[model samples]
Every structure is written in structure tokens, then in C-alpha cells.
Target: MSSLDGTVAAPLSPPRPSSRLPRASDQDGSYPRPQMLRGAWADLDGTWSFRNTGDDPAWRTGFPDARDIVVPFPPESPASGIDEPGFHPVVWYARTITRAELDAAGYGGAAPRLLLHFGAVDHRARVWVDGQFIGEHEGGHTPFTLDVTEALGTDPDTAHTLVVRAEDDPHDVTQPRGKQDWHEHPHAIWYRRTTGIWQTVWLEAVPTASIAGLRWTNVDHATMRLTVRLSGERPAGARVRITARWHEGDEDLATVEAVVPVHAHEVEVVVPVARQQNGQAEDELVWSPETPRLVDAVVSLLPAEGPEPLDAVSSYFGVRTVGVDGGAFLLNGRAYDVRSVLNQGYWPESHLAAPSRQALRREVELIKELGFTAARNHQKIEDPRFLYWADRLGLLVWGEAPGAYAFSPLAVQRLVREWMDAVERDASHPSIVTWVPANESWGVQHVATDPAQQAYARSLADVTRALDPTRPVISNDGWEHTNSDIVTVHDYEGDGARLATTYADDAARTALLGGRGPADRRILVGGAVDEGQPVMLTEFGGVDFQPGAKREDGWGYTSAVDDDDWVARITALYDGVRASAFLAGSCWTQLTDTVQETNGLLNADRTPKVPIERIRAAVTGR
Candidate 1:
């Protein structure tokens, strides 16, 4: 069979030897809502009836004839057990639900509403319960939910059918398809396309009226603002009580509370938090990569005339502020240079989806071990579990959105709304200090010369700031900046000596803008560089192969013939970058080697290619 990208289909090949396989416990059945966790929930992963409908509408009525597929893994990935790879434009998934299962999940309680959550479904998804339509959602990266209590039928004696229909067209450049290749086979830069559910799916039971969402904004080290959004019916005189706990490694610091009336569906409240030991604010307790401190918070709604609180949820926040000063990134009122590595969040067997929560945490641990304070989640929005670990473990992150290749009305519509959704979904986290909407002119390529394209880029930056004022927004990541908080450029100049000269001073910045770098790459587009904004070499030093490593048909900016040569070249590049008089930060080419791209400091399986200590010394200059 030919794929949609005009290539013949073949059986899925085995991954590299370093690839990590999914464990028996890798179903990710844990609580989906890390920000707001509740007690009553059920994991909806495991085997399910799967059928490739391929744009056929007949599969919608009922899926009586379908084979088995493991939940959470797409058909393209080997972990899913169905490794046949031809484009599946439409697919159907079905599973059975029984009264006993509902009762075990606590959905049988009085006034309980059954909520079905899909961590993510590619492109577009339409859901149904017991042959009755429920709802549909667009955007492949964000989560969606449906209330299916009524759809489960009135009779509680019988079982029900849960069905989902997902549609995706990776070849459509108008949609926001990240590194997923539209080609028949994987090629340069772009890898495989993932359709259907690439993330977890589960069910949770909540009260008739519960807290639906939360958004946190750090006003300062002593103050934090929270916007709580409620769901379900709003009774008269409903009040919400918020309690925040400050703990210093099991030693309780203090506890504070705020009671606010919920007149409407959403209400905002300012909570004052102090890091005190002997009645004085301990400035050292503030959050930073060096010392990551978190404050746990619990929220409960109090009805006007009820004995117990209406609803309660568990969440946490960090007290920190991020801003930009003259040519320096500031963290907690001090200039802090960000030493980060570019991580694409890809695995050999799992592709976009991670095999387990441990895998995500291990990546963050490795980044910290390598002496990097932050990571640029290049081109991908990344798994929420990864962000959770970064927040818990104290690693900074630059949140990035995938870019569309072409510019059209549909492309604009797709990128803007989806970017906003992605930002909103991740805004609450303190680890994410910067938001990048476009990267290297992938979606808006004409921003340099075209006025309309420039306007769109500026509009995206404005939208990002409007939604999240606490963090800085990078309009377009690499060169051709329009209205960016940080002036970042990607220059893969392999020669360490010449690379140093390109960013030595403002004169070098001018000369490089006139096509002076390797491959005659243009550093600035339309001669646009805000003199007052902070400058960073967001990408550089893609030293390809290391010593004793078997040479495969791989690609990188430059190749090191031996281990000594690799060390010298990589160290020289870092030396040049750090020696720059104008550079406030630098992001290396990558953290791990992806499929065809072999420019990672670590192998695909998270193992270090070179000596960990040597790489750490070079990166941190310690």
C-alpha cells in the first residue's frame, strides 16, 4: 500500500539497540491532572478494539469488527503492537464499560458526574458512548474532556460501549504538524507521523460542582496570584477557601488561607505567601534551578448552607519571577545566564510519546547532571509529565510550539489558536520562563521582507504576552526577528575560531548579518536587531560523531573523526560562545541524538556519548 506522502508502505523496522522498551507498568495510568489531583479516578489504558477506517464514515455507527490495539501508542509505533505504517487518515477505537467498573472508580456515588478525559488525540476527534454522540475537539497537542454520565444509559444493570473516531492528515501543511515527516519515509530533520491517541486516556468522577481549572501568576517572591475557574451549577452565595502550605523538606514553615466568593464561573484572588523561619522572610527559599522549592496548595468550595465543602482539589505553585534586563535574563531580580541544550523529546520506540513517567524524569535528571540549567524544548510542545518533572526537579525550560511550513489563512488560523491553547495549557508552570511561538521562519517565512507576515508574527507575540505577562515571548526563535523579547540566532559555524569572531562585538554582529558565517547564512533578516534586547546564540556547535563510535549513514553540521578531535572541536565551540562579550545565553544543538540526526551529546537512549565530566566542564566552564 502507498502512503499519503506517495511512498510504498513497509513493516515497522526494529529500533536501535539503545532504544528503551515499554514496561508492563508503562501504561501511564497515574493521575492525568497533576496540577489539580483528586482521589476518584480510573485508568482507561490497556487493550482496545482498533480499526483503520481511512476516511470511511461507515465505522462511526458501531465498531463490531475491529482488532486489538494497546491504548496510548499510535499504530505507527512498535509499542502499539500494530507496526504497519501507511497513512491512517481515520481510525476507530472501542472499549467496554461495566457497572462494576464504574462503581470501583467511585462514579456510583450520589451527585457524581462521570468525566472522560483524553490526554490528546491527533488533529480532530469525535467521541460517542453507547452509540450516542458525545462531543468533538480539534488540536492534536492539547487535552479534551466529555461528560458521559447521561450517555451511559438509564439502566445501570448493563454495560456500555465507548467509541472514539480520530482523523489526521499529516500531509496538510496548513495544520501544525511538527517534526512529523509528510514524506513516505523518514527523511532529513522530519521523522514519522503519529495519528490517533499518542497520550494517555482515563476517567474521573467529580461532584456536581467542582474546580475545573487553575492559572497561577507569580507577582513577586512574596506574592502569587491565582485565577480559579469553576465548573457545573453555581449555587447562590458560593464561597471558595484556598489554603497554601510552605514546607521546607518536611519542616512546616507556615500555612495561609483565602476565602473568596464565586459570583461568576471564574474568579481571581491574590494570595500572599512568605518564606519565613523566625518571623522573617527567608530569601533563599525562593525558587531557582540551584534550589527548587515548591509550595503545595489545596482548594475547596464552601456552599452557603452546606455542612461539608462542595469540592476540593490539590495543586502546587512556585514563587519566582522571570524578566529581561539590558542584555541579560533576570531570575528573581538578578541577571542569570541560561546554559541550555536543545531537546527534541523523541525516542526510538516511542517517537513522540514516552514509554513511562520514569523515562521523562530520567531525561531531566540527565540534563541537570550535565550541568545545564535549562533546556529548549525545540519544535515540540512536549509531554506534560516532562514539564512536571522539570518543575519538581528544578530545571528551567523554554516552551516552544511546532511551526507550519506554509503561510495561508488556514495556516494562520491553525497556528494562532493552537499556540494560544498551548500557552494557556502550560502557563501555570514556573519552570517555563519563555514562550516561543515560531521557530526559524518555518510557518511565517516572509516575516523579514513581507509586511503582512511580519504583522502576523508581531500579533502572535502580542497574543502570547497578553495571555502570559509574567514570561517573555520570543516571536520567532532564530534569525529574522520581528518583535521578540530575546534576539536569538541559529549559526552552525563548525569552525571554532571563525564562530568566535562572528559574535565578538556589535561589529561582528553587523558583519555576520551581511552573510559572513558558514554556508553564507544570513544572521539578520531585513537588518532587524533591537539593540536594547538581550542577545543569545540559541543554536550552535553540532559536532557530529564521537571517538570509537560506529559511523552510520547519519548527518550533523560537522563530524569529528576521533574522540580527541570531538572533544577539541566541541570544547572550542563552547569556549568561543562563552567568551562572547554580548552573549547572555547559549543553547547547544541538542541533548540526544534523534533518528537520522547524530549531533547529540548523548545517544538516543539517554546514555552519554562522551565523558560526562568533560562535557559538563565544557558546558559550564567550571
Candidate 2:
């Protein structure tokens, strides 16, 4: 195999603080797929060959340039060791896979096939194995995989080259790049860009005919349903074995099992849960932020003739339903008001990537401690690891699709495809109660007047419902909503009394009748207000507080005089949202400071700027 030799560039910059965070255990270590896991896999995440297409055209020659850089971290991130903030339209990555490693990982046999998984790559990605083209994928925030067993030599001791090329267009507003700075340097709201691979990359071995994907749906508190999709060469009379166990805080409560024959490459199985003597569903461990209960699951593919199971995967799920009843947001048949904070998914040093899995958990824990039950992951499809913790810890999430600024055919197609992928990948997690496709007219600005834009918004909501009917879909979050389960608005009124007056019951009615509402000209796009739908002040109260000195050119909705002033303003604004009887919920400006937006409750390093208790009291009114 060709080696990386002369293409290495000089060290660009020193390591940032985020790079110091402990790396996850080796591949096959911390379990990237904690929910649905196979026993053996290889971690291909340490280092890889890197080259910018402009620097060299080695990718055309079927060999990557001899440059070394860390895998998963974007070249623009300080954690990547090559902190070049300049834009590179096309970049390439190459890594070697040894057959010995494959053999040890149970991928040696002729029947077992190797699946290469990429957690994410910005914009578009084209991949190859041993000079043989494999596949290409668009949309950067979702995972995609390729089967590469055919490319590996028949010998189990040879090495194969895997090459990848990613194309990210900073100026292309048609692409969905959430909060990634379009300019050369950091600007008002956008931070540094994430050009290439920004998450984990690994490999797994699966039987030729095995389970491809799973979708979990809770029919009710007592009945759970799962749909298993199969791929590969299926043997006749293949069946699936499913086992579930209820758990509350590590304590096992009950167990249930089911088996169903697979037909037409798909099968749906229902597992009925028993109840205790007190008439409570034993497996009802209904999932919620305050009481996060999960059910451990093991699913196996049972071949007709083999005594041993063909393939078994370990997974977990929560039983819960999120819906809307009248003006109240219902969670599992009860009225629930959302106390949410916006998380832009950015770090001072890591930019779009989290420092570690612990960092992800800490953010959720901090959100819960601050008296918030839900977090709106703004403009970005967050890491799966974050969703894993959200499931285990019981936090509600608004899984939003990153926005594309310009509206075009390319933009619509890309957003739809990527959003569907994002929904499919994270639909099983009970934490994501809602799917938000557009934010504040980022992509569909003409929804109010343009028929096509209005139809597009409605289509997105319809498609989302068709994909996962269990959760609500916010077609266009924060204004001009065409067809949505919830009408969300963003109002950054700094004064509590003014905010209260603006959102008053009479004010809401008057604005609706006048064909416009507060928080920009945001009104029901195609019709009058529907009293049955819930209204949410999804964004408000951005009181800027830079501890040392005031930033003259930084961005925040409103400026605060001091710490005390900031706290008072925040409390006042929240009080307005809390007292508005017409609204079902509200979300604060943000959870942490990102780039030049210094209006977060927490500092850049995730340390609380305002006392946690004080903020908690303001949000929960305790």
C-alpha cells in the first residue's frame, strides 16, 4: 500500500483547550452504537492521510497525498491540529485497513461482509476502497455507510486503502450549514466552519443476511411495537427474536419476549407488557425528564436451520408519546409545559464538535439542573452520542434540521433528503419529541406569499408525520408557519412588562385578526389562528453579559448593565412568558455562549456565568 510520506505540512497552530479533553476509548471501545450494538467492530479514528484537492490532485490518481491529520475532527477546528481557518472547497482523506484486524474482528470468513460507517462529513462525500469506487452521499449531518468486503483481497493478511473526498462550499447557501461562518473569519452569529469529517468513523462486521435497521414505536403505555428492516442475502424462513427488560435506575423490573417470521424483508412485532397488582403497567416505565426509565432490548436473527443465532444486537428504548391537546402540550396523556433552552451545538475550541461524550452528558445535566426540561438544538442536527445521553438521562429535545439560507431546487432536495435521514436515525429516541425542519424563515422566507414555499412547508410537515407519526412536526419554527402542530414565535423583548403586554391574550387575538403577530410579521401562513394548536414563545430573553468588559461589536438582542441587572432582566422576561396563559411553553435565548453571541447563561467553557440556582429559580419560578 502507498504510504503518507512527503505531503505533510508544517504545524499550523497549538492545540486548543477542547483538544485536551480525553479522547473516547479505542474504536469498538465506548460503543458508538450503544442502543443497537454488535459484539465486535474496529475503530478507525486515530489518524488518517489528509490533502486538499487544490494542493494536490492525488485523488484522481487513486492515491491520497502523504499528509497526516487526526480523523473525525475537521481540519478547520483547533482540535484537528491543522487549524487553518481558510476555506478549502475540496479535501481528501485516506486510511489503511489491515486484513488481520478484520479477521480478529470476525470479518475474516467468506460470508461475513464489512460495513464502513462514517458518522458525518460536511456537504458531500465520495468514497472509494482499493481504487474501486464505492458510493457517494449528500447532506453532511447524517451518517452513511458502504459495504467494502469485495474490495479487500481474498487473503486475510493483506492491507487495503480507503479514500474519501469531501466537497464543502462555504459560499453555497443552497447547502444546509447551520451557524457555520460563511465569512473567512468569525462573524456576528456564525463561528468557524466544519469542512470535513466531524464525528466518529468505524467499521462493523455483519452476516450476509442480517438486520439492517430498526424503528421503535410505543403504541401505548402497555404495548410496544418495533419494525425491523432486513438487508443482504436472506435465507428462506428467516425469523427474529426480540427480548425486552424494564429498568429504572439500574434496577431490573420485568422481562418480555417475542418472535415473528420475517416476510418481504420486513417484520413488525408487538410485545405486550404486564402490569403489577396495583394496576400500574410494570413495563410502563414511561419516559420523562424527571423520571427517565428505559427498557433494555436484545434482538436476534434466527436462521431456519442454524442452531446458533445468525446475528444479535443489543439496544434500548423508552416508552412515551408526545402530542398536542387543545392548547396544552401533552406528554403521555398528561398536560406538559415545555421549559426549554436553545443549544446551538458549538464550543469555543471545538466549534461544532463536542469535546467528549462526557461533555455532551454534562450539557444535558446542566440543562436539567437549570430547571429546564427541554432543549431546542438550534440549526444543527446534534451528535448521536448526545441523543444517547438524552435517552438515558431523560431530556426532551427538539431535533431541528440545519437551515439553508437560499431557496432553490438544490436546497429543497438536499434539505428534504438530509432531514429524512436525520429523522430516521434519531426517531427511536424518546428524547426527541418534536422534529423542526426550518427555523425563522432561514430557507423558506416567502412562505407568507409564495404558494410554492407554503406548499413546501406543508409537505415537509406531512412527510415528517408519514416518516414518524409518533411525534409532532414543526414545519417552520418561529413564524409564518403554513402547516404545523405548534405555532412557535421568537420575540426578544428585553423588558418583562413590555413582553407581557406584547403576549397578552387580547394582544394575541388582535394581532391574529389583523393578519400579523408579534416577533416579526409572524402569523398563520394560510389561515387564521387555530385555538387547538399550542403557541410557544420559543425564543426570548437574550440579556448580554460579558464578565470582563463590554464588547462594542458583539451580537446579543439586548445589553445588560451588570450581573444583577442581567439577572433582573432575565427574570422579568421569563416572568412574562410564564404568566402568558395563551402560550404553552417558552425557550430562552441560549444555554451557552457561542462565538460572538455572548448572551448565554453559561460561559464559553460551560461554566455557569449566572448562579445555577438563580437561573433555575427564574426559569421554574421556584
Candidate 3:
């Protein structure tokens, strides 16, 4: 799969779907990626035959004539050849998959399991391999894997067609759709809707009894707890051997062991990689915004005495702990000091999908260069590419969610499922120190409007804690309070100090009413008094954005200021924050401008807008 770094090949819109089912005109044809070719699977992102025609029987076999439908990007993109308005309820795409080399590699050799992986498919999707139903999946942002082994069909396989049918309600409010405007074009808070297959589609072959899943926790320097789940039809009395390799400098440490169990589900095994280096197992150095060192390893599963092992996937880990002590956040067992920003992970070209892997890396680069160690990835859940980059770059991230506005039990279930998957997939990364659910009490507010937003929020926190107690969870981050580990809040214009201290209880406030400074029932610290909690100053410097006409006054995303005045405003805000003892570390509203909101230190194109040296000097108090 081509990593999203830069230089998008543009995008093409798929044919708009009609609510009707199979159409005669379009049944024989679809996108070209469906063709069973020599390379197994080709990049289906370039220009393709496209036609919005309702249906034609000719499509069932092949297209008679068509426009282009870019893979991985929905129809309505400006880059897409067909950028017309209107949402499609259903869309169809057809591609063939056939690997003559792969088919020969297996069968005669042994049992081969061919798996098809879809990085992401918007809404509901159904796949038919060789005209036979293969499988289906639901979810726009995450990934799904289906086994095409059964549908590959028999002997000396000839090239075959694989058709995929998808139905997406870009306007559907039920799914975990993010920031997509249901009616018409996008504005603030909402943007263009992405429909259909918007990510990669690839295939891999695995032997029977292969390693299905892996979970690892970095306990410390020497010892790490690993859970392995093996899959495939196996011999009842089969034995699988597992081995690990850790390479550090000139010294290479390896571990080999055999497991003889009745069945293979999830077995925990411990390995001491750090102890080899003469350090306490628990002393495994931690990775954070400051020191982002990573340890890489390979997990191999083999049969009895076979070296060609069943499966081996490359993985990496970082050493760090995340938690809360006395209502104060801590990283690496110490009271954590944070100066963070909000990262939405958006680009002008791909929208939510990053332009490339290098593009994803650039995100961490910008976050670190901005003089901040951490950032709150607001709403839109990020791609795995982002987490991988964060782990390598040592950028502290607060894994946020794509909050739902409406409260539905189904939606809640999906939220927990998708978020739990995100946690599981990226948990090994040291940069994700925390998980924040229900930002500003969107669904939490309506779900549990009674006294505390705790029920929904706290339940998620408890779940997160149960999964990984090492990290803290900020349930319902905002004015809405919950009995969470950290009392996180976001204040636009008010007593920043008093709000920060509430967690420590050094200062308490009765309430705030859209005003700043001292008020009745004052509990805000920095009121020239004590009795406030150990304030964090989670948010403060939003003082930067471009100012236009009153019609274009959307500074709420970030403080609207002329691009020329951004440096001055940013510097002044940093100075003001450092001057106040009540403010520990303040995460400015943003690190880069996204969409129409231009408040980032860097523009949307990842170009630096201010002098880096000056910003660094201001941050270090030079």
C-alpha cells in the first residue's frame, strides 16, 4: 500500500447511487481495480472509467463506456473529476482478484489462507468474490478483514471478477460519521462527506494455524507481558514454537520457547529484553514527548521443527507509564506537566485521510517543533500511520474520539467498540498517554444530563482503566464535571486559573457565566489567594487566526488574527502564560490551520508561518 506522504494523485467521484437495488445497465461493470491481474492487486486510486448512469446490463461483465472513479476518495471531492453536489445512498464498484503465482505457491505446498483487508470503507459494504458472496463490514473510519480462502474456487484458477457493493449515508447521523454536513456543503465544525472505499484494499496469504492477533505491554526495562492469539485449523496435538529477537547496538538478544497447549486462544508469555542490558526489568526507559526511543522486535510462530514458521509480523514498543496521582496527571510515574494543542488531522486534499505517510510524519514534526510536548487529537480518530509516527517521533497524544451528537444505545456500543479497537491497536505506542471521551459533553450532555455526565463518561473511563490502568482517562473533558481521574475542562474566556485549580481544590468556583475575572462564589486560583487544585491550564493561547469580513468571522476554531500578526500574538500569549504561576503548561488551541480555520503556527500546507528561532526563544524565556 502506498503510504500517504505527499503528492495526492487527485480523486475521482464514483457513480452516484440510486436507492434502487441492482440495475440492468450497471450490473456488468464497475471500477477497474476489480480485474484479476498479475501483481495480485494494483493501486486503484488513479483515474477510472466513470459514469453516473443508473444501471446497464453491460456493466455486469464490463463497462461499455465510463468516466473515472478514484479509489480511496469519495465522489464529491474537487480533485475528483465529478465534484457534483448531492449525497449518494448507495454505490457500486467491481474489481477482480486472481494470483496465479500465489495460487501455485499454496495448494500443492500446503493449506493457504488468502485474506482480503480493507483499510476503511464508508458505512455498509458487501463483497462478492467470483460472483459469490464473500463477506461484509460496517464502519467508515476503521478497518475490516475477510477471508476469501473459501471463495477462491478450485484448481488451476483462472482470472475472475470480484464485485463490491457499498451503501453509504454520508448524511446518515446514525453511523460514527465525523464532522460531515448532512445538508449541502460544509462550513465551520463540518466539512465535505467522504463515501465509498476511501482507503487501501490489499491481500495477504497465510498458512493454516497462523498467528491471528498479538497484544504486548511494556512492563519495564527487562520484562514485557505479551499475549498471543493463534488462528486456523490446527492439529489437536500440534505444538507451536514462539521466538523473539531484540537487537540493541552490537548486542542482539533472542528468546525461544515452545508452548504445548490443548488449544491456542490467548497465552501470556513474559520476555526480559531490558534485563540483558543490565537494567532493572522495570527500569526499561520510557518514551515521551521528550525522549521517544523505540524498541523493535519480531514475533515468529513455527511448527515443531519447521523454520519457515506459520507467521511473523513486525512490531515495536516504547517504555512509558501514564496515570493520575491525587487528581494530577502523571507521565512515567511523575506529576505530568503538559503544554499541548488540538490536532484534528485534516488536509485540504484527502480530508480525514492524510495525504501520505510522510504527510502523517510531518504532523508529529510540526507538533514537536511548536515547542509543545503534547496535543489533544480532537474528535476525528486518527489513522494508524499517525500513531506509528507519534510513537517514533515521541509526540504525546491524547487519543480523542469522533463524538456523536445524538445519544443512541447502538451508537454508544459502536463508540466503545471502535475506540476499544483503537486503544488495542495503538496501545503499544508510548505517545498516546491518555484517552479523552465526550469532549465538551456533546453526547455525554444529552446521554446523562442528570447532575453528572458521569454514567456514560465514567463508564468509558472505567473501561479504559480496566483495559490499561497505566494511562488516565479524562471522561467528559469540559465544563461538565464527572468523577473522573482528571477534572478536565475547556474555558474560552473566563478565570483560567480558577478552573485549572479545581482539580487540586486549592481554589473552587461556584459558577461561571460567559465572563472573565473575579465573580461571586469565587474559587478560581490566581485570584490573589490560595485554595485551588494543582491547575494544569489545559487551554489558553487561542489568540491567532485570520480576520476577514463579519460573514467570515469564525475565530472560535482559533482566535482570528491576521497571518502577519500571528507571531506577535503567539509570543505574547506564551509570555503571559509563563508569567503566571497558576498556569502550568498551556496548549494553544491549535498547531496548524485546518480547513477554513487558519490559526495554526504552520499553514495548512505544513509550511512554517513564523520564524522558528523567535518562537523557540519565546518558549524558552530567552
Candidate 4:
């Protein structure tokens, strides 16, 4: 198939090796990774000796004599390499992927869409297939794909060697590294940095003429509409048939079918009430964070000549809505307040990668148990595991980016691109309600005023609109916030009333074009705090370490170095902060202690740092 961008699909110009089958060196204690992956399916994880450059550096030639670290996990992380010092910043990764699957899939299709899907490669990495120069990809946060359809040797049944070279310096502030500190090990709000293939790699097979993508309009039950987009060569009357199977549990439910003529890149297929369209019963389940019901769908293409499954992809969708009338936010046409905690998805064992699905679900379960409906993932693009559970477990979410504290046009471009991929890849979930670009102006200058930053933020807004416009996007989360659907504000120790002072200033100073969303955690500051504004107090209440105990410092208004006093003081302030109407909602500092900053509601081992009862009182106001 031709490239989606109109460029000729590049083939294996370089010769590939008829090499031996590739397999990971070590698999002991490695994550039970998923069987299947999207894009060019490849798994570049397993076991490799990890050593920082500061150690004896003699492993470049033959295998170094050292402890084994798991692949895909950064050397800085305990999960990767030996639990000792993390891998040297510049490290080499070795792994192999089965090419037989690619050869088998290409049996009947035009050709196998063998792509190397890297969830994320920190700093930068170069890729090789069977020692063939596949390509190189930069950017550590987003996912990227490479078409290596022709790179595999002629043999249809052999594993091809896949090599990746990763390098990252902790001090490089120009990248979109959320909270990694270079000089010292992660301390005081800073966590360890993960470099190289933090995400998954896989190969996916598709027909020459395949449905590139599809859009579900997630309306109400009776009026579910979907748009089908076919890529590649299409005849004038090329017929595309879509079969949608909606299910609740084991019980087989309803199935809807539609056929449309394929245009260049799109074809709008309206699915009206079954009765309204063809006098058939139209019954479909709705999805929300609460119920989080999912309806499954499989799109099949049948040519006008007869019946043939040109392309088929099994997908799921959720039906939900968000809006606001007066002051309250609404979900499913009802009032919903955004109560969230800053959730940074990090684990003691797997910095970003969750050991198992349960690890991911536990985070969501703990958040709900804390008596909150939502969580704002602090500053990083989270793994899909979190979303998978958020959709099933009923937790509203405010998705944030791995912050770009250092500003750059190139960095901004990569940020927006990766974010777009994240948005489109995860848009079908029901829990995600908000989108963000800039968080606290870490990498921005006069973001609210600077033309470039403004344009970048606006461009992100535009991209979000083009991709999924239903949700809202904050151009810049905090500083110089403008051009957003919601009035998102960020404040630290300010009281509710003092927090509301900004809105008062906005109301008093600038003309109100129209009311936007209650700005982030600071939706409405209120009376109280002669000392400060009646802050919504969105971010408060994180004392991971015991008070009076010396641990790593964290980045927040109040750091709880020790759990005893700091925890009590931090939790108490949150309790006091929530007592004002000036604040519409509040999300605590964070869900878990990411790396060294241990002031999470939960501990590094998924343990509750603070007793659940202590935190629930503040959330439920008991």
C-alpha cells in the first residue's frame, strides 16, 4: 500500500541478513508482556546487563560481566538492568522479533505492513532489522512507526534481529522530560529519567486496501454514528461495508450493518435509530466513567461484486457527554465536579511500565477509594494501561502531557505530534475529559503572550480539534492562560478567596466574552484567607514519606520530606482548604510517590502512604 502521506512507501533498499532466529537473552523476572502489539509489531524488551558510565566500562564488545536488567525499563529505574546504578546514559539494546508472522500475513494481502512500533524512545535511538538499516526515530514521549515490509529476509519463517541504540543525558533540559533532574539523583519532586524504548514494539498486518481508521461519534444509544475512512487505492464505486457488534457481557447483543462508497480518505456513515431508519429496534448500551460500559465493533469491507472482508479491525467505544450549565460540570447531562489528584504513573519496579494490568488498575481503584471521581496525571503522557482500566473501572480523567519544561520549537513540534497520537489513539475511552499542553510554563516563556508559544498552544488546540474536538484543551495550563474553552488556573498555598481573586480580577479587569469552564483546580476561589485566596485547593494533601523523616524532596507547594509532621500538616491544610465555596473542586498533590518524591496517597509499592480513612475525610468532607 502507498504511504498515508502520498510518499512512495519505502522498501528494503538495503540488503537484510539471512541471520539466525532472534530471541531475548534473558527472560527471568521480565514483565509478562502482551502477546500482540500495534503498528510494526516488535518486542525489544527482555534482559541486558546495565551499568552507568561511572562504573567499569568494558562491556562494549563482548557481553559485559554484570547483573541483568529488564529491557524497555530505563537503567535509572530499578526494573531495568541490575537494581544497582541504572544503565549508562548511552547504552545499546539487543533483541529479536519473529519475521515469520509478517511473511505469513502477507500471504494474501498486497504486502505485509511490517512496522517497528516504538511506544517511546528517550532522547533518540537508531533501529536496525536483521542488521538492515531500518531507520532512526527521535522523541522520547510519543509513539512512532517505521514500515519495514521489505526488510525481512526472503525466508518466510525466521525471527529477525532488532537492535536499538539509546542515549540520554539527565541534564538535557531541551527535551520534554517531565520531572527528571540531571546532576543529582531524583530528589525533591524530581524522579529518575527513563531512556530508550519505554513503550512497546510490535508488528501489525493489514490488507493492501484497508480501512485506515474509523471515528465513532459516541452519541446517545439510539443515535450512534460512525465515520469510516479507507486508505489506499479506491475505485469509484468501491463498496465498504461496516459491521458493528455491540455487546455488554457474555450475552450477544445488537449488530448494525452499513455500506458506503469509499471516497478519497473519508465517508460519513450516519447510523440513525434502527426504527427510524428501517423500522428495526435500536438498542445500544451507553458508556460513562461510572458504568464505563463498552460496546464492541468490527468493521469489514465487502466489495460490491460480492462479500469479502477487505479489512477488519476489532474496536470498542464508550458513549458519554460533558457540559456545564451554571457552575457545575456535567457528565452524561448531569452535574459533575472535577475532583482529581495529580497522578504521575510511576512504579518502584517499573518507572513507567506497570508490572501487570493489576498494577495499573490498582491506581484507579485507589483514587476512587479516596472519595474522588477524577485524577489529573501530573506531567507525562501515561501508558494505555491506565486508560484501559479507567474505561472499565469508572474514574473520570484529566489527561496531561509529559511536561516540556524547556522551550524549543522542535521540542514543541514533537510534543504536539506525540500528543496528537495519544489523543487519537486514546480518544475512544470514556474517562478522559480534558486535554493539556503547557503545565506551569516549565518550558515556556510568556506562553500566554509569546507569539510562538501562543501559536504552538493554539496549534495544539487546533490539532485537538481536528483529532477529537469533543473534549476541551488548555493551550497553556497555568501562566498567561488564554484561548481555552475552560478557565484553568494553577495556584499553590493561596487560600480559596485569594485564588478566586484572579477570577475576580479577570471579571473586573477584562471583559467576559463568555463563561468558560471553571478554570482547573482553581475553578472558583472564594471567601476566607485574609491570608490568601479561597483556593479551589485542587492540589494539596500529599505526604508520601512520614513527617520528620528525611527522604527525597518533592516539587509542590508544600513538600513532606518526612511523613509524620509533614503528612499531618499537608493533609490538614487540604481539609481546611476544601471548607470554602471559593473552591469548586480539589485534587490532592498526587496519587503515588513517583521516584524519590514520596508524598503520594499511595506508596512506592502501591502501599497507602497515608491511611485511606485519613484522606477520604478530606475528599468526602467527613
- Counted clashes in each candidate structure: 0, 2, 52, 52
lDDT of every model, 2 decimals: 0.78, 0.78, 0.57, 0.57
Q: Report the Cα RMSD per candidate.
A: 10.7, 9.9, 11.0, 9.3
Task: List model 2 lDDT by residue over 1-622, tens digit each.
Answer: 0101112123222213113222221122256665677667787877888887463444733453467778777888777777788897888888888765676456855337888888899989988887788888889899998998787767776788888889999889989998887899988778889988888888888888877888888777656788888888777888787766665445556666666777768889886654532335532567888777777776777777543566766677887778998877888878898999999888866678786668888888898998899999999999888887888777899999999988889899999999999998999888999999998888888888888888888998899999988888888888888878888888887789987877778566456534666655756876635656888889888778888876766668988777788888888898888767688889998898887888899888988886789888878888
Candidate 3 positional error at 527, Å? 26
Order the numbered candidates by TM-score, best leading: 2, 1, 3, 4
State, as a TM-score between 0 and 1, how close model 3 is to the true structure: 0.79
Over the full model, what C-alpha lDDT does candidate 4 score relative to the true structure? Answer: 0.57
Misplaced by over 4 Å in model 3 are 1-66, 79-86, 98-111, 155-157, 220-222, 237-242, 245-262, 273-284, 305-308, 451-454, 494-505, 508-539, 547-564, 579-585, 617-622
lDDT of candidate 3 at residue 248, scale 0 to 100: 45
TM values, all candidates? 0.91, 0.92, 0.79, 0.77
Candidate 3's residue-wise lDDT over 1-622, tens digit each? 0101111122212112111112211122221111111112233345444444464434544454556676655666655556654676666676555455355324324347776767677767887767667788876766777877787666545665656666776655657766666767677656677777766666655667666666667675345666777777664554433333333443433322334342556656665443334534433344667766565444445555534545554445665666655544677667767778877777767667666656777788877776778878877667666776677667888887676666668777877777776667666666787777666666654433343334666677788877877666666665443434554445443233433443222233323312223212112111122223334545555544543443353444345445455555565556555555344345666666666556666666777666766555555556
lDDT of 4 by residue, 1-622 (tens): 1211112222212111101111111111122221111122223456644444442223332234445667667766667644543435776665546545454334324434554567677877776666676788766776676766677756766776656667776667777788766655665566666776676665555566666666666554346556767766665567655444444455545555556666666777665434323323321355565566665544555554655455555455565766444444557656565778888877777676666556677888888888778888877777666776676677888777776666686677767766776676666567787777667666665564467765666667678867877776655554344455454445464343543443343242132222223232222112101222112334555544543345544444555544465545654565554444444456777777666665566766767765777767755666
lDDT of 1 at 395: 93
Error of 4 at 482 (Å): 1.4
| Per-residue error (Å), model 2, residue 405 | 1.5
Cα error, candidate 2, residue 223 (Å): 2.1
